[model samples]
Target chain A: MSPKSVLLWTMQAAVFWLVLFVPQLIVFLLVSNPPTWELVLMVATGVVGVVHTAVEPSWRYRVHRWETTPDAVYTLSGWLNQEWRVAPVSRIQTIDTKRGPFQQMLGLSTVTVTTASAAGPVEIEGLEHEVAQRLVVELTNTTQATPGDAT
Target chain B: MTTPAEVPAGLPAAPEFTEPLQEWHRLHVRMLVVRPLNEGVAMLVPILVLLFTGNGEKWRLIASGATVAMILAFSYLIWRTTRYRITEEKVELHTGLLTRKQLAVPRDRIRTVDLTSKPGHRIFGLSAVRIGTGQQDVPGTDGLTLDAVTQQEAERLRLVLLQKGTAPRAVASEGESAEPVPLPESEVISQLDLKWLKYAPLSLSGLVAIGAVFGVLSNYADDLGLHPVQDLWEWLFENPSLALIAAFLVGLAVVGLILSVPLYILQFWNYRLTREPDGTLRVQRGLLTTRSVSVEEQRLRGVDIQEPLLVRAGKGAKLAAVTTGLGSKGESNLLLPPAPLSVAHQVSRDVLKVGSDPTTLRLRKHPFAALRRSMFRHTVPWVVIAVGLAIWAPSWAWPIPVAILPFAALVGWDNYRSLGNALDERYLVTRNNSLVRSTVALQRTGIIGWRIRRSFFQRRSGLMTIGATTAAGAGVYHVTDVGESHGLALADEAVPDLLRPFLVDSTVDDQAERNA
Candidate 1:
């Protein structure tokens, strides 16, 4: 994971926490009678938010890995818990590559592989822009070449 | 790749049919009669209402004639625009006037040619054709339909498309000879006997149908005006009494029961399944509105036999196909309608014909840890309700949980009893029950991968849920809450070699002692 992506995540988390925290802070300060426990809990939320934003992106980056074989694409990702998924090239309905502003700044993109299955799509994120583009083309070619698709 | 075009066992090879009759055939002209008749009836209703009330007399006669002209003219324009044709490789339909749309589906991709008819169309020997490609139907793109064709034409269309598209190279080569080969007789495989109607009331369809009947009635009332049943309510409130209320409820129930019986009969009357010589399963049924649906043999993965709680009490079950791309919308692909348990099994075996009956396989039971956890989970709600009721409203609801505890315990026990899974050389079977007990027999060849789920709670208890992911059926047949190692081992055994890299080292002392 790039330092830029970590900074982006932290900034996003900071905005989300601030939107929630500012109101509670203002209400407590304005109140004539404030409970000590409520003040302590409000402070705790800010600390938790800061700690979560600082650690999560890099920690997730450590555990996440993905690879595409000739006939299948596999992804392993999660933080507290991990899931490994394999999507056969034959069953792929479409492959899409997307880049949000944060990813663009890091020169990274996400490749999404979709199938008809109800388990939803498999996403391989934080890939370099050029690599993700090439991966999409390769996966698309494999899908088209496989004639007797199961789904 | 396509198989060698072998027919199902005991059925003779089918004769070759010519290239399906082409050109934009606009269904029998008589089909144009149905819509105009409906429009006429709708227009007639207002005229009749006006005449009965003895009002709007001056223009009433002219209004009737004008309405009939408008309906006939509009229906004729619509009928003129509707057209369908079958080419060598695709089925196409074109319809609509101002905003027109043309839909084309590849013949080989066609999953079902569902023929249906209303009583009006039936009187004229006409039917509607819905060509199902087994994909999620886009309103215009997927469900290509010809609103009305002669019954005879519909049958020939169904036969020609299924035979050519399904048989492919064999039929194409055979047709080249242009030889008049003798057609083989399709055997009557499974016919629903009238005695099976005893199982109708046992179905949840009866309840759903009852709700539908009420829904129709309410919708009709809304259309006419508010308070259509205001008099009935006034009478009901005015004459309320213990016995009268009992009689009223019983009367309403009887009405619902009456609706249920006819709806059941209409849905499943004379249900007959036939095996065409070309490996197609044809289902024909319905009383007022006849239906003819065909499922190709090549798509058969396996079968799912369901026994709902009420149906089980009567020793009856429902059989549905576990095929792919059958457009999972409000469709069960009823291979065998609700029937006696023995008959259901016999049909399942006969249909599958894969050496042994996968339904009868003795499935492995889940661990006691799962059952214990479920039992506590089930009873906890009742205990909470009991406590809450005891402290709050002491009189009425206390007896509710008095009866609830045992039922909750029974539900947990039944759920535990229903948990089982077995995998072997040819097929994998799993049995489980929530309200409806389902035993799914899936072809092992159809399975694509394994998804093992370990939630935080499951991890704490050393359990995992393993799903056999396939294209057919619900896409995943899950065996829940098995021991972690057992789940991994089952996945390994089923797929042969896939899960090895995912397993932890043998040096760790795991609780899955029974995995071996």
Candidate 2:
């Protein structure tokens, strides 16, 4: 995972909170008859958003980790709500590398490995772009070497 | 894996087909009678309305006759155009005149072959052969149906399609010469006992059925000039006596219980489970629309034992197969209906051929923190709601939340008690839920991947939910709220080396992280 990934996360969080914050901020500034409760709510939301934006990225950076062996891929992600996923190489159906606009700007990518199970794809997010490409190729080679329909 | 290549069992020894009839075959002529009758029955209400509204006019009779004739003509056209053929590699069906449609399911892909006969077809000794593969997202697209075939012919096709015989000679031709294999003996595993009917009324399905009927009626209540729910509410408002409302509820419960008895009889009149010599478990059931569903043992991933709350209270349970391509989940894979719990265990053991009952094995319970989590989880929300309601407005409804607190705690405690998981020799067993208690014994070999999830609360409590992802059953089975290390250990042990690379000692990891 890249150190700059924290910046990406903060940006994403800011964008999300901004959707709620902007209109309230506008109401507080522009409307002379703005409700007192509305002012209190807006300030409370702003404080939360700032605190989350500050503390979350670093906590997530410390928690998120991914590793691959010859036989399987293992990943642990999330700060407060952690998820650990492991998929055997023989059962892997597909491997994909994705780069959001923000991720691309930061030269980071997300790699996802899928099995036939509908549980979900195993995703390793915030890897350096070049590392993600290498991971995808490595997974593809391992899957091809193994025989049998993944399902 | 490819379809198991084995000796074709239950096939007639004498090669009936001397020449392979690769030619497309039309549906049985018997459908000509059945299809038109079915259409007429469907149009009966409209015909009756026409007859009554026409004031005994002769035109009404002629119009009804014309409609019947048109339906008969359409049925004839459909029968003529619909042609299905069993080639060596695929079962192909070509139908529809205006918009041509062709469906071909490969011979090897055939996972289940079911024969169904509604009263209309049963009268003429005909059955519909439904061929299903693994694909289930789209209902009709995943399966091929031969609307009507002679019962004997349907049996032959089922045998021919499912059996990937050692030598491929002739397909589903009427008189194709193929090597004759010995008929496989049918072993009866379990059959319905009249005493099992006692458990029928305990099932809440009757209440659900009644609710569905009410829902449909409510949709049309405006047209019918009836307002059942509104009238009931008005009555309750007028008479605020709790005893009357409780009595009414008791009456409704009685009605529901009585309704379920007939429904049970109608659905499971002649339920039977048998192991056909052909490596398939055949379930024969239904009183009205007789259905015979066959699940190949090769596709069997595991077995699931379900005990719904009411049914469990009565010591009754249901059994289902966790196999692939048997059709959509609940309806198709049910091996035993709500029967005795003992019978469920016995049938599960017989089906899996395991010496000991996997589901009944002793399970490791979740930690004490999990219990506290459940208590806090269930109690807090109601307390908050009560507090909010009191602050919002002082009302008679204050008692409602207070009264519900005990039940919520009961639910939480029950759920916590039900939380357990274990690893047997060949199956990883997990038990969960209080409302619909399910003990799933999934094959160790069938587990394709593992997912361990810990929410914010769970992380604080040192607990995690471990889910096993598989190709069969519900796709994922979870052991919820186990100690984090315990869950990791179970995941590692269940799949051998899959989770070993990721697991680390908590004590060491905590110290290292603190140092860093």
Candidate 3:
């Protein structure tokens, strides 16, 4: 994960909160007799969303980390609830890189490594696009050399 | 659908591969008899209701007769069209008149072969064989089913599918008949004891059975012109007697106990676990609808010793295998019914072929911070509800939530007591939960991945939860609320060097390399 990931995360959070707020805001503005308490609740939601957008990204960036070795892939991610996951090379089933619209704009990509077990998937988010591609190729080559059904 | 010509010229012809390219065989002719009888019995209730309740209309009689004829014809068509065969490479089924679906599973992927003989099938000496490959998410993709085959044939298929590369047994000759040959010598791991029936009531299956009986009775209450439940409710309301209500509850409990004994006898009348000569663990149970479920020793990942609250109070536990291909539904992987905890431990040890029971090992308990976290999680909701009721609702409602706090605290402490994890040489053991505390002993080699998680509160408390993911039962077994460093160390040790790179202050350890 890069330091720039905090900015990306903040932007993502803002977009998420905005998606929730816009509909309620539209209904409140357009509807003739919207409840007073609903407006109060909506305002509270806006305040919480703004505070969350301000605080959560930097905290998550401080917590998120990822590493890979010739033998395994390791990752620690999540904000309020953090997860540390490890998948071995011998058990690697597939490796792919995904770039969302925001990620494309920021020149970043997310690499996901999956194994046979449903519980074993290590996703490394907010990486430099070139670094993500190189990591995917490296994982593919190593996994090919490993021999097993991976189940 | 594979023709003999598809075998290319260059490859060596394996003997088993060349054989069993024989013919696609139809289900046993006796299935025509079994299927119609089974269908007729299922429709008996509705048909009787019409014949007895209708106003003697001629069309009602004609409709009942026509329905029986349709059932017979449909069953015959099904039997005629369904064809299955086992080749050296795959087990194939080509069935369905309308759709013409073809389903096949490679021989190597076959995981479990279940033989079930419902009463109708048993009457005709037939058994239904369900071949499962463990990939059950798809609707009709990998599994193959042969309904109502000759008992001998079902046994033969079971042996052939489970022991890959083995030549299938010859079909029974003219004199041998439909009687299944006795299985080869097997060592009995556990068998039903008469005393074990005492635990049946505590298992709570009887309560479910009683509830089902009430549900059916209520459905017919209007037809019968009687509503005992409604009458009882009215009488209770008129009298307003606490003693009467308590007496009714006691009566219900007695009925539940009485009902459970017979249900238990029917379900597990001759329950037995045996290890066959081929290294398959077989469970044979049920009186009327006899079932034989086999779990390959190779696919056996671990065992779960489950203690449901009521059953645990009676010092009993149920045991089930956590294996690949045997889906958890139908309790098909169950090794032991609610039996004495001692017997469960002994059987678990025997099944794993371990000298000692890993589930019974003394596990390292989580930190006191874990207890604090659990207590807060468990009791805080009730306390908040109480405070809310005090502010917004009537005074009596607040006392109700306040009254529940002690029980919630007890549950929290029980949950804390159950949380522990241990690593033996061969197995990684974990136990948790209060309602149905399960101690799982998973083979260390079976673990394919590791996940360690920390909530914001957990981070503040210096606690983390570790999950060991396998391809077996439930996919992942978690060790909740352990110290972060200890969890990382445990993960590293469970699968050598799998987590070494992630360990903060990593050191090159030669121990794992030497073990490998």
Q: Candidate 2's error at B57, in angstroms?
A: 15
Model 3 local distance difference test score? 0.83
- Tens-place lDDT digits, model 1, residues B1-516: 222344556755554355565777886888678866644664666656544545667676677667778788888888898888888789888888999988888988876777888787888888877776645413324367787888877877787777743343334364344443445678787997888878777775756776776676675566567565677778866775769868877876776656666777898888888887667777888888778878777777788989988888899988888875454444537888788988888888878876567888889988888887678778889999888898899475687897889989888888888888888687778887756899998887766656666665676787777777666657678787788767777777776544454454321434365464
Model 1 chain B worst lDDT window (10 residues): B502-511
Model 3 residue B282 CA deviation in Å: 0.8
Q: Whose TM-score is higher: candidate 1's or candidate 2's?
A: 2
Q: Across residues B64-143, which tens digit of lDDT does each residue of candidate 2 receive?
A: 88887888888988898999998877999999989988999887777788888888888999998889775533444547
- The local distance difference test score of model 2 is 0.84
Candidate 1 runs further than 4 Å off: A1-65, A76-84, A100-107, A116-120, A141-147, B1-16, B36-77, B134-142, B165-176, B222-259, B328-332, B376-406, B497-500, B503-516
For candidate 3 chain B, which ten residues in a row score worst on lDDT?
Answer: B12-21
After TM-score superposition, the amount by which residue B2's alpha carbon in candidate 1 deviates from its true location, in angstroms, is: 26
The i-RMS of candidate 2 is 1.9
Query: Looking at the true structure's interface, with contacts defined as alpha carbon pairs within 8 Å between chains A and B, what fraction does model 2 recover?
Result: 0.65
Off by over 4 Å in 2: A21-47, A99-108, B1-85, B92-104, B118-130, B135-153, B165-178, B223-226, B391-394, B504-516
DockQ class, candidate 1 = acceptable
Candidate lDDT scores, in order, read 0.73, 0.84, 0.83
Per-residue lDDT of model 1, residues A1-151, tens digit only: 3345556566667778898789889989899799998888899988987787778767767766777777667676766565566666766777898888777877888898876555536788878788888899898888888887455
Model 2 sits at a Cα RMSD from the real structure of: 5.3
Sort the predicted structures by TM-score, highest score first: 2, 3, 1
Interface RMSD of each: 3.1, 1.9, 2.0
